[model samples]
Target: MNLATHAALLGWIPVVLLLFASLPPRRALVAALVGGWLFLPVAGYDVTGYHDKHMVLSAGMLAGAVAFAPGRLAAFRPRLVDLPMTIWCAWPFVSSLANGLGAYEGGAAVLFNTARWGVPWLLGRTLLADRGGVRALAVGVLTGALVYVPLCLWEIRMSPQLHAALYGFHQHAFDQTVRWGGTFRPMVFMHHGLMVALWMAVGSILAVALWTRRTLRDVGGIGMPWIAVALVGTTVLTKSTGAVVLLAVGASVLLLADGARVRALLIVLALAAPAYMAVRLTGEAPRTAVLDAAARVASPVRLASLRFRLANEEQLAAKALERPITGWGRYGRWIAYDDQGRAATPDGFWVIALGQFGLVGLAAITAATVLPVVRLAVRLRRRRAAAPGAGPAVALGVVLALFAVDSLFNAMTNPVYFVAGGALAGVDVRSLVRRRRPAAAQGRAPAPVVVAGAALASPAGSAR
Candidate 1:
């Protein structure tokens, strides 16, 4: 919206180029995706179309990938796992055409949607489809969150003014930033305080998981244990109860659960969004029970907020059912209006997808995001030993599942999850877990034990 915002948004193109030119393709992708998502202005320009920073970043990455990592792209063979994302990208165009918007509109929608969702997944699949690449991504996220620590703390102490101070506008309502008896819930560069909270919480979970697995000990010279503590403390300071709860659940699973239990939990989390949608559409949302449970723990204001969201979801569900198949197209066609003709807004992404693209679209998007985790879960279930060296991938799968769970209540979309999903989609469950033959059986000395990036001492007490 402002000069600085425009400059930062447009300027990221060259930054993407520089990253690719200077770093490895996978690392470049990670840096470009994470850095742009974190610091770029939320607004975008409408040169030919409404090209936001997300599209711009994806475009730059695509170009960089084409020039630098063409082999990855050339060798890409579409599999059953890719169908959901392909459909997710293609369905918008179909929905547009179904609503009589014609091919031009449909084609354009396809391009934008693919860039928003597909390109990131493709990049992850091509560039980060291995064990080292997966760890790099996990580290990239942890590093990005660590980078946000000071900015978040500053915003928490001083109010969420960095966006306004730097970009010449506040990204969201100022009142939303005030929480916990006037303490600040920092938004930093994200669209909402909750997003920042979720980011921090996820980082905290990864820090702990990686540290415990010994996959990572230090990020940029700081010890992982201290990094975990800082991230955990900052996540709590963000004042989002939901994100904190998710962090707790993820950490608990990683710490306490065995392979089977973790796999089961991942499946549940993966199914949560779809199940909620189905329940809402069938008018069996259990609103009263949910509200009663919320009432026990939530303040009156928070309780009212939940009640309002549920009520709006019911109204929106009714409206979405009018079209049923493809639902309404873009603009405000999918939105319900009251007697005063004011449009009702959707708070959750699942409802928004249902309204805009109907069941087919919703399922496509859900599968695109959630299916990879399900597949990874299945693999882990079958091969329990893979769970050790697969810490980063498992952490990513957990985050993806949590992203699905969060989509039920909030609508924040980060392409990094797609990156993680794509990685999981292509990763071999046994990639990181190396099998060593017994010394007696092989008539030779045993090899060193390495799991999750850390090497265990061999029989002679020497680390590899």
Candidate 2:
């Protein structure tokens, strides 16, 4: 590790610990997590390949939650997703048997990988499970964006020296920072420039959602609309093609939504990319026809990239099927190897999940992420009128849609993917809770459930 990375870790860990002692459980939890992801050292700071920052604050927060806020423990209680994740978590250890790397190495793979898979989503979901918590999270994210704006702008001019300047090493291939547009993309503290752009995109969408819902007006000081505007600008300047498109779509949805029942639309949107992915990865997709159709809107170079990417996924999927149920396991087990045993890196997140942990891993995550989204949509189908705080749910769906698009090509393993997943699940889960309450207390007839999500940028009681 570089001197700067060591220094940054020494700094953030203590600060997070202090906040744990001084701040409220939820606030401290959120602060430690949000702060860690935003400002801490990058990926090179690893404990035997695991990012120590993620393990320390993220998984640590859940343990802290159990000790400090036991009553809110229901947040960690898995409903539909519990079983699959159990399998997902345990399979790495089992796969180690076939691809055995011995006890110390194998155990470390399972232990750290589980922590990585669990921490980010758990921290967000556990702390931000309730209405007030979700709103706080929205505001926290916006504030992070507001804080990051100047840094993002400066990095653009300076050509992304923050990671190198602060951490003493770049987190990704420097060549990858090259943009299709004639400029360098900024990485800042985020591991990659693409990650920075996606982070900005998610923040801008949340800000735009808050602005459209008129909840930001309640928070005094700098105007919420201005914050959204600033965040949107940063997302564009980040020079990530996917993120810019995602932000524009989210902003358009928030601005143009007419309070109609969009449940069917949300389901279709959520399922589209995943379905297409499943087909393509399984070698059933009409690649030529689809690429030809897409060529009308894309350049030949982009189309070739897509085709080549799909081909890579096909090779990786075949490799995974050798083990099928349990997968190839760690030690670059999932990556395709040359005759010399040199590994070719896999591209998409789904293929990554399939290769490392098998279909079970993929299924667990899908259940955790996609099922709740569809369930929420189905539950909300009958409601012709918008609920009090349905805006956040709509916003979450839009965020998920954009994430779905990103997941088609990239692995959804970063902080943003887990944070957004937990946010969506936590929001929909409230509706699931309301469905089971007594009719008198619910003040409405029992149905499947239509969680209004959280108040988002609005006050606490806005959801209730």
Candidate 3:
């Protein structure tokens, strides 16, 4: 994934897109922002030891700084959701220091680590700060992945040469691109073909969510139904069972419940993934029955992989327990070893988080992501009232939960996840503000507040 500086400087293409995106009817900016994230080369130009798409993030951070500068202070105001996120961001420094690595080295590592989640989270909070913004973010993701569909089709035929052709190096192992039936899987510009499948899964779910709410026209056009099907087609082509499973899960939730309930379900799911990991790590869960069920449903190959991951996670969890509080910290410290002292990388992101940051760090990150959906779901259910951004919030929350669980299987380092999370954070905070408005503010009676504005709540005070 390393793009040489000359090739990496080309990363500015999407940041440059912001110029035209600013001319938007809003979708324009979303397209630019998301296009920048999805299309940009990953691991472009290292800062310290961690190399990722630094230029892409710089584009977002640059935009946020300018947008919130000077007279625009209120737009930058913090909400209850920010508290855990703030902790999430700051705790890395604590963990880094605890690593007992040289202070300077630990500090440097922490800076780039912050970029992994912090920067994109900030982009959503600032750039797309409203329901329109949230919708735009979702559509932007759809379109961004849509843009990849053609590229994916190309790779399916030609194999994944796009990154090497464009950036002068392939992003992943050549053998991994060769799939079950000997067909080539599309990697596009992502770290792995699985990552491509994951993004397509997110896009498919997002498109269907938009179509259900009829906001597809706002972002894509009347042809969005077809577009959704096409995205689903791409997901199937990915040959990654996880993508297919998530698509069914997302669509079923959308069909059965309103956005609030969907979000509440997401809260439960968010908690459950880690909880299972906790149980599995302790060997306290019914391992035999779980594997038997997975064997019954999953192909033998897939079930074997799952069992292997569970076994590895158990080993890593035991090692992590030795330094339960602050965790093993950077380098190869978080990795586990056998009696022969051979090291193994923990396969799950949650496992890695547990081994590296311990429970404190894990809880902080999990809460940072989950609480926004929880807050929105509660607000949506309690007053039995529509909430601002609930439609987009629900869709985004679904992606959030799907991705969170997927992270247990995959690292979930895709910047778009953070962008969605930050947008949900903004949506949650904004809904809270609108709900808590003073009677004086609500008493003014502003245009009936548009009752059917697709989950934008009317002021309770406006009621008879």
Candidate 4:
């Protein structure tokens, strides 16, 4: 079938499943249907992008289900998970208004992006705050990886020139013109390679979680090491240095947090660096001749990346000074013309926030993005120490760490980030609720006996 036909079919499948979910015999069917819907193939089928189509269809189904079936809706009520973060995210809207930058269409842009992320986030908070949501997310990641890995492999094999032609690497055409590499890195369905890499990184992390927990062996018949190896290999093939760094850092954090000896952790990190450098040096030539010599060592590649990022950072800083308070309005750079009638680079995310909305706007964006992840981290540590068997908390912590690291390099405004963020928020909010509920505290026991037993049974159990 064609792409549109496939999308329409998949989209309708959910609706039919919802109908069945409303029936007594097939209520368990909805969960599986949702899981399957998330991983359905859309490779050749470009029916308005699978994610976009799924979002639209899912929204419609959710609305209809809520209207027709209050009981089902109640099953999806917002949990206490990450409520603080949800509240914090509201600051951007307020800051936009305060800075008076929202006067033009810029306000609308802020509102639109915020709503796009915030709404699903809220929905996720309600629907996914429980074990089922956790399972759904895990299943989705594994399924997405299963589908995405082979496609990525094929694209790399094809080395299609069309990849760059379609995506347009770097921020501007001039960068592409100046660079030695192809126009864009391959992104079969995602917006860019960085995004694809980020998604793969998340998969790799999830794979770690699955392997460590022994879930992969039980469910997928795959050993943990094999899953980890596959995920790490896929990440490397993406040619995203940032993603590689993220994986390294995230893995380290996971290892330390899980109580690996500090000295052993340091030794592992120290040894891993040289090995990583060797592999990276041999991977690909630099983007420019000047960078090629530097690529002889990994430090140069890292420095070059940092330098470009810093340049963008500097440019943004200069622009922000022009309107430090309210700054430029939304799409203000587009509409607000200078004496020379030239537009400047939007630069990095920090600069984008400042230039677009000014200092006030930047602060709002910062709080919204930072607070929940921080709160989640703190809460996870406390919860894990007190209870210990909180799988969802551990997973959420990994998600937070990945986002925190990746956001420094790429914008966190993508759909994948939002979807993941929403799920994490849901988990966090639920944890908070459990902590606050007097009845829950009084009745709840320490971390589950199963987790404690597992910890004692095997040395590898410490990996989780």
Candidate whose TM-score is highest: 1
lDDT tens string, model 2, 110-225?
67766775555665566665544555565656666666788888877767778777777776788877666557788877767877888789889877776677555523346666
Which of 3 and 4 is ahead in TM-score? 3
Q: Name model 1 segments beyond 4 Å from true.
A: 1-3, 48-50, 381-387, 435-464
- In candidate 3 the C-alpha lDDT for residue 232 amounts to 91
RMSD (CA, Å), candidate 4 to true, equals 10.2
| Candidate 3 segments whose C-alpha is farther than 4 A from its true place | 1-21, 24-29, 48-50, 58-60, 67-75, 218-222, 258-263, 382-389, 428-464
- lDDT score, candidate 2: 0.64
Residue 152's C-alpha lDDT in candidate 1?
A: 97
Sort by lDDT, top down from the best: 1, 3, 2, 4
Lowest-sum lDDT 10-residue window in model 1: 454-463
lDDT of 4: 0.48
RMSD of 2: 6.3
Instruction: Identify the leading candidate in terms of lDDT.
Output: 1
**lDDT of candidate model 3 versus the reference:** 0.66
**Backbone collisions counted per model:** 0, 2, 0, 10
Candidate 4 per-residue C-alpha lDDT over 117-217 given as tens digits, one digit per residue, 9 for 90 to 100: 55445545555545445444454454455446666776566542333333232222322222125422445544455666777777687666555644334
| RMSD to the hidden true structure, all candidates | 5.4, 6.3, 6.5, 10.2
Query: Candidate 3: how many backbone clashes?
Result: 0
